[model samples]
Target: MTKRIVILGGGTGGTLAANRLRRALDAEYEITVVDRDDDHVYQPGLLFVPFGLAQADDLVRSRHRQLHDGIAYLGSGVDRVDTEADRVHLADGGVLDYDVLIIATGARLVPEETDGLTGPGWMTKAFSFYDLEGATALARTLEEFDGGRLVVNVVDMPIKCPVAPLEFCFLADWYFQERGIRDQVRLTYVTPLDGAFTKPVASRTLSGMLQDKGIELVTEFNTGEVDGEAGKLISFDGREVEFDLAVVVPAHGGAECIERSWGLGDALGFVPTDEHTLQSKARDNIFVIGDAAAIPTSKAGSVTHFEGEVLTRNVARFLAGEELDASFDGHTNCFIESGFGKALLIDFNYDTEPLPGHYPSAVGLPLLAESRLNHLGKLMFAWLYWHSLLPGRDLPGVSTAMPRAGKRFETR
Candidate 1:
């Protein structure tokens, strides 16, 4: 008798989970992955795409190729999950039965939620780097503009790569300087959050960086509408931020299929899972990982990477009839690119804000401090992502748990 493991959404989490589980599980357990297509975009690269540092072709690769040899890949859109029957329904009228189900469907951008955002100026003056098409179009737009009000706005929170917006601002500063128009472009950052970031220490650090770069920061502006013809982002309280060019990080939600499945997800279609255990609240035999999990964390690749490691062991333990491990500590880390060839690193878990100090200790890569070496590390990550990260090879020093050293632990 063989066990069936069906993983949905072959993005970062799904792909990595399939590969690692295939290596760990025997021939008696069959692993199958379901996704819409084979196009896997190196999502972080999209930030650079608009600035010409990356290309559409460079960022996308065949998703099926990233999986292990034995893992079965189904490149079709999912329709719904018959959790009661222990099966998944496909959009094209196919079905998949599983002894264990893993939801790694991640998230999708909802641009239409904002009035007039996806209207006339979309992809022309208003754009996003959250996806491949938006990044490609914004790249062309940025290359042609000499100088204007370039406003980067976050429509809401719980979005992917939370630091990416700040990185864009930093890179914009560098981009304009290189083009000899640094003084001409007026850069503004608008977010629904009260500060530059969710983490207190990182927010103070990043907010100061915005000030240093002459990027105006507007906080707590809940967007009401985008008056594209008038070139303004109007907040619900009638506050308006005018912009000649807008790079909007729109609201994000989990896959629609997750929503269609009753009691499987939250209002945003994200799976309500045990934050530590990664077990779906709706079913005992189902687990959720990555962005799809409705966890109070940034939906970033690093988080997905960490979740995969912990989830793999738990899945195996479940099959072996053991107690579930509650070791996943909402662990996540990100590199903050702060332009001028400098970057900062931050590491923390659910209960900790990004602190200043060396990671893994008080003396490794300086955290919350801008360094050129960290910038090099940031650039080198694209290579590491393709060759090391997706392959599930454990880096010697980078542990899944957030480190406590090298942080300025003072109160905000």
Candidate 2:
């Protein structure tokens, strides 16, 4: 008798898991992946798409090709997951029975959540760079604008790549400088957080950069409505920030299919996952990973990559009837692009905020510090993302556990 391992998504987590397990597990276990489309996007590249740094074709490939041999790839939307019966229902009325399941359905952007967000000014005066289409449209809008109040607003938290909005503002500074209109462009970063970033130190550092670049930092401004017709962003407290162009990071929610599954997700549709083990609250055999998991960490690709390793091992442990390992420490690292061919890297976990240090080894890439080398590393990551990350090849030095090497602690 063979065991069936079904994965619900073919994005970062699902694709990597399928390929990794295909290599580690024997031929006896049948592995099947279900996703809506065959397009595998390098999501980070979407950020560069608006700036003409990356083309659409360069960021996407066939999902089937990324998977390992003997792994079945099904291109169909998941209708529902029957946890009790250990079965996955497809949108096409087919059913897949599995001994183990990996739910990586990821997340969806909800621009419509904000009143007047998807209105007449959408894709005209207001745009987003979170999606490829939105990024492309924003590129055009950014190019056409000569000088005005350019405001970047994040409608809510838990967005994919929380640092990306800062990156966009940083790049916009450079973009305008190149066009000889830097002084004319007024850049503003509006976020619900009290600072530039989620962490205090990094927030201070990023806030400094915003100040240096002449980008106004508006903290704790909860966006309630986008008055696209009026060219103003209305906050919940009745404060309105007028803008000629708005780059809106809309509210994000879990996949709608999660709702159809019944009691599988939270009110926002995010799967209720165990923080340490990534196990679904709904069932013992089902595990959730990546953006779908309601974790305290940023919904970034690096988080998913780190989670995949721990999750794969846990899935194996679950199948072999072994004790679950609570080794996943919510470790997440991100390369903050600060323009001018310089970038900053940050490493931390759930208990730890991002600290300044060298990562992997005591001498390697400096964390929480801007360096041209880090910028090169950020560029190099696209290759690593496609070849190493999606294929599930563990890099030699990068580990799931966050290292304290080269870190300086304050004495009480």
Candidate 3:
């Protein structure tokens, strides 16, 4: 009898893991991927959509078509995981029994968690670019805005693409400049973090950029409510920031199914897993990857790609009754758009911070430095995502571990 492997969520992590596992395992294993729908969105493209750089149609594709032919694809929402019974219950009254399970359901934006965020002026005065509809609605909002206090607030931390709020600010500056109303717009970036970003060095660099663009930085702001009718963002500390137009990144949480699955997740619905091994702490036969795992890392697509490499290997080892490799180092790399056809690339792992140098090779694209070449690389990623990343094809010269060969470390 062939062993069964069930993967939840047919997004980036699930699709890549399914394809990679199919290629690695022999005919003795059956791979199945479950998702709620057929739409596989290129999430990074959402940033470009509001700026008219990319379209909604260009960002989505058939999730079922991305998987390998031998892999089974189920278009249904998951109800819960019966870990003790070694089975999964689906919303459509179906049950899938598996010898091994992989959870890659990813994070969800809960706008309703914030008071008045989705009420009154939603899609009119306030908006979010985290989803396709929100991005499209915001595009129209930005187009007609003449000027005034344009505030971008991050409701909480651990949101998907931590750098995206900063990217929006940068692009907004460029957009206003292009329209010859740069001076009319007063841009303010409000975040709960004490700095512009999570990392210190990068935060300082980004903070300086914000100042250069004449954008105000409001840090240590814990949002209490978004009075959309009044166009004010109130923080828990009694501080308030008023806005004529507000772009908010709502609080993110794990899928509801994870919480419904008893003893399968943390308080936030994120699965607790061995950070390095990617195996669930709740059960030995279960694995967690991407944003679904409660790991101290950026919940970005690049992180998912790195996790897939280690996760697929570990899953194969587990099925063969071998010791799993605890080798994942929270490796992540992202291209930060700084607008005006320029961008910055940052590569870092568990112990290393992003440094100024070249990446992959001594002569490769400059790291932690803005350049037009990096912007081009950012655009090229959309092509790579569908053709290489999702297909589980190895990107040339890129490895699972963060490379130190070309990085320049700063002396403390």
Candidate 4:
């Protein structure tokens, strides 16, 4: 008899994990990946779409082609998971039994969760550029507007690529500058957080950049409603921020299947997992990775790549009835595009905040500051994400553990 392994997503973490496990495990293990669609999107590219730096079509590829030849791919929406029966129910009325399960279904955007967000003024005066459709629509809107108060608002926390909202503001500044209409456009960045980023040192560094760029930083503004008709963002405290064009990043939650499966996810539809082990708290045989896991880390693509490496080993260990690897240290790192052909990179983990340093090894890329090299690295990541990371090929010195080499740390 052969053991079956079923993965619930074909996104970054699931694709890498399946490919990694295919190399780690033998032919006796039947591996299958299930997803709702064949379109595998490079989500980071969506940020560049609004600025016309990247086309939405070019950033997407067939999910089936990304997977290894040996592994099976199933395209179907998930209905729910039965932990007790160890079965997965699909929206198409199919069912799959598994010896072990990997849930990597990433976060979903809930624009309608905010009052009046999807109402009359949506996609006209107000827009969201996080999705390909939204980004493409925003491009057309951006071209028509000559100048006014352009606001970028993040409705809630725990959004995928937390820095993307900031990036949009930075790029918009540059976009207007190139059109020679920047002086007429008043740019503002509004967030629920007290600073520009989650980490203190990085936040301070980024806040200064916002100041230097002449973009207003509006912190702690909890957007409760988007009065699109009135062209105002009303906060929970009843304060309002007026805008001529509104770009909002709405609240995000885990996949619907997580919520549908009882005891499988938290209130927000995110799976509860051991942060280090990536083992699902819902059951012994189920594991989690990426934005679906309720972990205190940035929901960025680099995080998924790092998590895939650690998760692949643990799943193998679990199937062999061996001790699971607990080496995942909540490590996550990403490059922040600061516009004008410059970007900044940051590396950190659960215990350490992002600090100024070179990563992977000494004399590697600089961290926590802007540079042209980092910008090149940012643009170059798309090739890496597809050809290397998704295939589970190790990138020379990059590891799941955050490196302390060449870091500038303070002594107490």
Candidate 5:
């Protein structure tokens, strides 16, 4: 009998996992990928939509087309996962039985979770850039406004990219300056964190940059309500921040299927995953990757790519009745777009925070510092993401382990 493998969600984690496993395993194993739709979005490009740096149409492509031949693709929403019997229930009333299950379904934005967020001035004065639709709508709103208070608010933590809101602020400054209205538009950034970032050093450096750019930072603010009609954001602690234009990043939770699938997810709807193994804490045959897993790391594409390598090895080992590789460190790296044709790079893992110096080695790209070369690297990633990453090809010099050779760690 052929051993069946079922993977959920055809996003970055799922696509790469399915393709990687197909290459490693022989014809004996059957791999199937399921998703809600055929559209595979390049999530990073959503940020560029508002500024017309990129088009939303160009960022999306067919999901099944990205998969390797011989793998199956089912285009339908997941109803639930019946893990007790090792079966998956699809929304179209189809059932798939599997020997091993991989959950790569990423987080979903919950704009409705916030009071008055989707009401009143939604898409007119208040908007979001996290999605393609929202980003496209925000583009129009930004183009018309010449003078007013522009507020970039993160409704909660664990957003897609923690640095995106800051990038919006930085870009907005540049946008307004180029339009010759920098002095007229008041810019501010609001977040629940006490600092600009989770990492201390980066946060301080970013906070200084925000000050230099004349953008106000409001920290420790838990938003309770968005009174768009009143053009204000009301915090749970009763603090109100007024705004003429609100670009908000709402709270994110796991897929809706998780809520329907009993005993499959945590209270927050994310799968409880081992930080080092990428295996589900719930079951031996079930594994998780990317934003779907409630791990202590940034939920970015880079994390998913790194996890794919280790996850494929462990899954093969599990099927062979051999020891699994528990060597997946929480390796994460991101390019922070600082606007004005410049960007900053940061690298860190479970044991280390992002530090100053060069990445990979002393000769590589500068870490935690803005440069034009870093911006070019960010622009070049779109090409790499489509051709190399989706096809499960290795990126030369970029490894799963976070290199510590060139980092400047402070004396403790």
Candidate 6:
């Protein structure tokens, strides 16, 4: 009997994992990918939409077209997973039996979790660039406004592409400068964290940039409520930030199906897995990847790309009844877009923080430093994401492991 592999979610991790697994396994293994829809969104493009750099149509493609010919694609919502019986239940009452299962159903933004966020003035005084609709709506809103107190608030942490909120503020500053209303617009960055970013060095560097850009940074703000009608963000500590226009990155949680499936995930619906091996702690036959896994790392596409390399190999080892490679070191790389057509690149892992050096080589793009070259590289990533990354083609010289050769470490 041929072994069956069922993958949930056809986004970056699922798409790449399906394609790579198809190439690695023989023709006997049956591989199938399930997603709620056919739309494969380039999520990073959402950041550019509000600034008029990218459009909603330009960032999306058919999910079916991205997968290999032999791989089966199912367009249906997941109901739950029966790990004991090794079966996946679809929302449409279809059941799929699999020898192996992969969970790649990435994080879901829960705006409803925040009080008064989706209430009155939503899509008008308040918006989020995380979703396509929110981005496009914000574009129109930004065009009509000449000046106001524009605030960008991140409701909670573990949000996708953690640096995107900062990038928005940076771009907003440039956008207003170009519009000749730089003095009129008062920009503020509100976050739940104590700094501009998660890591200390990166936080200091980013906070300085915010100061230079005249964007006020409000830290340790645990948002309790969004009084949209009053245009205020109330914190749990009785503090409040008033805003004329608010762009909020809402609280994010895992997919509903994960919650529906008993013993599959945490309260937030994120799967608990061995951080390095990507194997679900709940079951050995199951694997988790991308934002779906509760890993202490940045939930970015680059992280997904790096995870795919390790995940595919681990899946192969599991099928072969061999020892799994626990080499994934929380490797994450992010291009932080600053104003004036410049960007900064940071590469790090669990053991190392992002330091000043070159990436991939001793003389590559400057690390932890803003440059036009990095901005161009950031733009070039969209092309790479669609063409090479999703197709499971290895990016030359970029390994799953963070290379220390070109990185400069500071001795504390």
**How accurate locally, in lDDT, is each candidate?**
0.91, 0.90, 0.94, 0.92, 0.93, 0.94
Using all chains and alpha carbons, the TM-scores for the candidates as numbered come to 0.98, 0.98, 0.99, 0.99, 0.99, 0.99
Name the lDDT value of residue 277 in candidate 5. Answer: 90
Which 10-residue window in model 1 sums to the lowest lDDT?
403-412
lDDT of 4 by residue, 298-322 (tens): 8888888888877888988998899
Candidate 5: where are CA atoms >4 Å away?
Answer: none
Q: In candidate 6, which residue ranges exceed 4 Å CA deviation?
A: none
> For residues 117-228, could you state the per-residue lDDT of candidate 6 as single tens digits?
9999898899999998999999999988899899999999889999999999999999999999999999999999999998888888899999998999999999989999
Model 6 accuracy (lDDT, Cα): 0.94
lDDT of 3 by residue, 1-412 (tens): 8999999999999999999999999988999999999999999999988888899998999999999889999999999999999999999999999999999999999999998999998999999999999999999889999989999999998899899999999999999999999999999999999999988878888999999999999999999899999999999889999999999999999999999999999988899999999999999999998899999888989999999988999999999899999999999899999999999998888888877789987889998889999999999999999999999988998998989888888621
The reply for model 2, stretches above 4 Å from the true place, is: none
Name the runs in model 4 displaced over 4 angstroms.
none
Count clashes in each candidate, considering only residues at least 3 apart in sequence or on different chains: 5, 0, 0, 0, 0, 0
Cα RMSD for predicted model 2: 1.2
Q: What is the lDDT for 11 in model 3? A: 96
Model 3 clashes, total count: 0
Off by over 4 Å in 1: 410-412
- Among all windows of 10 consecutive residues in model 2, the one with the lowest summed lDDT is 403-412
Q: Give the CA lDDT, 0 to 100, for residue 168 in model 6.
A: 99
Cα error of candidate 3 at position 243, Å: 0.3
Off by over 4 Å in 3: none
> In model 3, what is the error at residue 242, expressed in angstroms?
0.2
